[model samples]
Target: MAAWFLYREGHLFPCYFYQTTGFYCLGCGGSRAVLALMHGNFTDALRYNAFVILLLPFLAYFLLSMLIETICGRRILRRPKLPGWAWICFALVAAAFTILRNLPFMPRL
Candidate 1:
């Protein structure tokens, strides 16, 4: 129900992270990012935080798939386990993305 929850209460949730830290972290702009995306403002969402913009669809699909499996398992193909190589690949990809995003060269990577 993550999508529904987000849809219903996009900005209603209080962020304990900011309240406790007194500084915005990597996930700080996520709510506004979601709001911007919902408002048909992809550019604004990316400007607010590219990570959030990039993560939403993946998260939505993941949640939906999980819900479908829990509710009606046979209709969908069984998800295969991710291999060790796959984990390594994902980690490398994430690290590369993080570094690129922070670097001065690739401003929009």
Candidate 2:
């Protein structure tokens, strides 16, 4: 419903980080990407925010796993504790994506 409203409104609230820093942050275009995904427009969603599109499945899985565990009182999926190096790698990938998306030749996301 919120995605529908946002789509109908034709504008998303501007990203404060983008406004101040003149660069796309890791979360830039995330709302629009979600809206596009909700509408089943995978290409547009990826265009709006590839990072969000790529990460959403894992996020959804974890959320759903938690919900199921709460309802059934049994942990079906063991939540893995991410090691420090995994976190560091994730950060590096995010930083790289941020840089790549901000390149002049790249489309604004």
Clashes found in each candidate (C-alpha, N, C closer than 3 A): 0, 0
Candidate 2 residues lying further than 4 Å off, grouped into runs, are 1-12
RMSD of each: 4.5, 2.2
Q: How much does candidate 2 score in TM-score? A: 0.82
Task: Count backbone overlaps in model 1.
Answer: 0
Local accuracy of candidate 2 as per-residue lDDT tens digits, 22-42: 999999988889888878899
Choose the strongest candidate by lDDT. Answer: 2
Scored by Cα lDDT, where does model 1 land?
Answer: 0.69
**Candidate 1, 1-109: lDDT as tens digits:** 6546766777746668768955444566677778778888989889867777887776777777788888996437345578999899877876665555555664441
As a TM-score, model 1 comes out at: 0.60
Residue 54 in model 1: lDDT? 84
Q: lDDT per prediction?
A: 0.69, 0.88
Candidate 1 deviant stretches above 4 angstroms: 1-10, 75-80, 83-109
Most TM-score-accurate candidate: 2
